[model samples]
Target: MHIKNKLSVAIILALTLGLAGCQSAYYKTMESFGYHKRDILVSNVEKARESQEEASEQFKSALDKFSALTGFHGGDLEDTYERLNDEYESSEAAAADVRKRIDAVAEVGNDLFDEWKTELSQYTSSKLRNDSRVKLSKTKSKFKKMLSAMRKAEKKIAPVLNVFHDQVLYLKHNLNAQAIASLKSELSNLETDIGKLIAEMQRSIDEANAFIKDLKKQ
Candidate 1:
């Protein structure tokens, strides 16, 4: 197969074989193949950031659709439902991708820090060892904060998704102007929740960007 396809297959297999559960063996294998923990950590963080960006857009699109639906005088309700449902699915997938990437980043980060600490113990020079230890501490602190922000953002997703799910299902049952009017009544609360979700997502995205920049500079 093509090189890109080969790489895609490899990644799918890696994830399927329990990237987290077998992380020790997985890391060893990747390292033997010349991919180190640092590379994985950076890549995963980028993936998480991308996912967050997509999720943000998908959510905003869904909100826009809802707003438009409220003002909608007439339209094919089935078509609108399908569009919103598609947006919800896309958002759900994006959220899942972000979580996966964050977990991968965390796993590699833990391994990298453990190895750094172990190597520090091996260093005989007090000044050099102390400096390395200090840098490691700072990196770990930043990573912890980033992970916390990411998890907080992730937590916000489920509630928003639940709201979307309810709206979608309700629409499926009552796909008419009357249903639209009923949902219009709910638009305010929905918008409020989505606004909160978007804010959390933006915060996490900013943290991810900073974290990625720091890692690159290291």
Candidate 2:
């Protein structure tokens, strides 16, 4: 891998590792609380907030790149800018959720982290263990390559978003069934891809937790 790619992988891995620890912290908190199968959603909300912040930075940084590579200022792309704004709003909502969850957890106790983890472990599905077992088998190099491939989709985001903006502008002046259909198709694909990534990450998280549980059993 090139140095730039290595750097990117390292950034992503560091972020991913931080996230795993955050998840572990939440699990531990829940275990200490001794709450069985309760929705300790604050961790996920925090993760979402972190994701949004990172994405916002990336989006802003990509603006310069977008202009240089595609001759497009993100400002000129109103629809795309709106999309970014929407993400910001979503992040805020997620942060709110995190606060609410924090309050709920605090009401229980300050040192309930370990109980929370134990409680969560009781309900974790065996499927998660199986899934994690498979993914965990890979060497770091292969895993990094896979992560890079997944991240490649994000590289096209600026140009793709710019095109979406242009299409919205195009629709304003010239409405056609074919164009509308095409727009929906592209948007649907984007939604599906994003959904898949989120699901995959959740599964990965579950797998990691399952591994932790296995360690505790020993």
Candidate 3:
């Protein structure tokens, strides 16, 4: 077999054997098979963006569903709670997925930096090495800022989730006209929370886009 194909098989085996711990090994194997860190970094950034987009949509859907619940009337109280609960659960999962994607991006980025630093030691020309080091330092700084923005948005989801959980649980116990009436006053707060959540999400998305553009040059 060709060397690249052998490395690919090894990567598959490593993944099958050690899914979580195989990151460094996975990167090395892929590098050996001719895939560079910059390529992986781009792919990871795209994944993070996709995940954030999905999370944004899911949260929006949850907001819509909660709005519908406020308008809810006399039919299938249990069924309504079930649907809203499902949306809440789905939103939670989407948020988790966003975090996971961001972590993956950071992992590949760190791997790239470590490799870049080591490779700098091998450079015969101090000028080129120093130039490369400066670029790496700049990239790391940008990444730190972008990652902070992403995590800040991620933290916004928790409070919104808490609100949803409270409403869902309230509805579960008091699935009556009175419970529905009480929720009317809560609508304003819900709307505000949802608005804030969406705004934060948009900010995170913007950061992700800016960072992706900034680093793709590498």
Candidate 4:
């Protein structure tokens, strides 16, 4: 690798290690307050679900703004562009939060599963050990499913954001009735994409709820 590339890799590794250390310290602090990794994982999953839910609404709102532009008749085109821009910005923020929350859930969940697996050997009774091992396996399986769903939804956000970004940029350059007409042609495809995105988000939210319920039960 080139010198600059090696330095970039070193910086990335250092940041990764720093974040991991901070997360470990935070977990320890929470444990002191009687909150285990399992509890934190559940909380993170819930937050992730909430973020998706909010993102779903924000995306829908952005779509609505985009759709309204199709019927633009004798109004200030600049004002309409501003509204769409605001919605796009809000959608971007919501998508970012969803990604952040999902990462948080994955972090705590991996830690919880790792600790659970390690502690299984400490059990004096073979029966209890086997039982815990089975439960851990089931929980891990469910978590993987939920995380997959979250990731599927997360993947959908970017394309929709890209489309919004393009439209917003196009409007910024050409804020005129003719530009609105051009955008009108793309509305159908955007609607279809947003529809799919919202559906996937709902599926992820449902999976998160199911995982949280199962975790609390166990």
Candidate 5:
């Protein structure tokens, strides 16, 4: 097989395995409810599900647009097309799988949220009971696991974009100055967006962890 094909296979396998592990981790956290925080975690899980869907759509659109722009230009487009198609298919599959995992996680989170709501209702009805710290700790760990899983997914697919970005750079170096400038500008924008997206994801995960820690003390 081509090197590009091999890379795609490896990436797909890594992403699939990591996300599956993430699902299992969340399940375990739900089972160990002493440290779980249902409300915030459920909200984050829903956000994660949405993120996965958005990412997948973005990946697909990029592939389609890139192909339209590059196809029939006839300069080693075959190889590039093959590599890109492989990357797109693999990434899409991984993203879809992650969304499925998120759905499962969300179900557990919703169940826990209902329980918390009932408990909070009782707390409001009577004297506020002592807060449970153990559940908070478990929630923090579970959030970390979700973050780690997302990081792994990002690592797996970011390389393909990096490769494409580098290719654009090479094109800029060899192509017409006007064309090069446009490509460079677009590539720069894409890199910026990717960086920003990753940063936002990290921030969300961090916020979840911090929130869980605060809940632990309550």
Candidate 6:
């Protein structure tokens, strides 16, 4: 490892820890290490896509567990409630991660666009400045489309979580076959909601991939 590269790594690590709450400082430090905002934006988009994928799977798993309650055959109701509660909690965590990743993408994207727009004034060549400006506009347009898709998917998460939370709370209080039977009635609607959520997440993931590819080409 080159000494310069090693030092850069160390500095990045220090900034990551010390400036965890200071995005501007962190981005500046990263830029100093040759990782400009465009690169960071691409990386964050990849992360957001992966998070959505994971979240989709987690929600599916939770739905499967929830659907299982419909077939309750008089076993340990407490155990059953505990399992469902765990699934609900896991889904919540996954949703939070998806939101966090999306926020990271948005932050880096905003910074990258702002920097690009600001730097256009520094270009003395009129032709080159116009070219850069056009590229910036195109990139911003694509990013907005992708971000909108991501947000639409994110909005679907809350309603599903709310349903799951309600069911989990009901089960926790009334750990009986009757309670399970009651929940069984809601399974179809829950399934439909989850299906919509997964579909929206897939759309978002696809948009992210398309944006990443387009950005890399530029």
Error of 3 at 175 (Å): 1.0
C-alpha lDDT of residue 192 in model 2:
49
Candidate 2 lDDT over residue span 118-173, tens digit each: 44456468886555444434322332343343244333343435544554555445
Local accuracy of candidate 3 as per-residue lDDT tens digits, 74-99: 79999998998899899889988988
Predicted candidate 6 versus true structure: per-residue lDDT over 1-218, tens digit per residue: 99798767856774585346877777767766777788878988999999999999999999999988888788898998899999999999999999999998897789889989999999999999999999999999999999999999999999999999999999899988768877888899999999999999999999999999999998
Candidate topping lDDT: 6
**What TM-score should be assigned to candidate 3?**
0.88
Q: For residue 139, give model 1's deviation from the true position in Å.
A: 0.4
- TM-score preference between candidates 2 and 4, better one: 4
The top-ranked prediction according to TM-score is 6
Those runs of model 5 whose alpha carbons end farther than 4 Å from true positions after fitting are 1-75, 101-105, 120-125, 129-185, 211-218
Error of 3 at 45 (Å): 1.6
lDDT of each: 0.84, 0.42, 0.82, 0.89, 0.53, 0.90
Model 2 / residue 37 / CA error / Å: 28
Each prediction's TM-score versus the true structure:
0.87, 0.26, 0.88, 0.90, 0.40, 0.94
Q: What TM-score would candidate 2 get against the native?
A: 0.26
* Model 5: ten consecutive residues of lowest lDDT: 125-134
Please identify which of the two predictions, 3 or 5, would achieve the higher TM-score against the true structure: 3
| Cα lDDT over the full model 2 | 0.42
Error of 4 at 63 (Å): 0.6
- The candidates, ranked best first by lDDT, are 6, 4, 1, 3, 5, 2
Error of 6 at 5 (Å): 8.0
Once superposed on the true structure, which residue ranges of model 4 sit more than 4 Å away at CA?
1-21
lDDT of candidate 1 over 68-93, digit per residue (tens): 88887776889989988887888788
- What value does the lDDT take at residue 193 in candidate 4? 96
Tell me the alpha-carbon RMSD of every candidate.
2.8, 16.8, 2.7, 8.7, 12.5, 2.0
Q: List pairs with backbone clashes in candidate 6.
A: none
Q: 29, model 3: CA deviation in Å?
A: 2.0
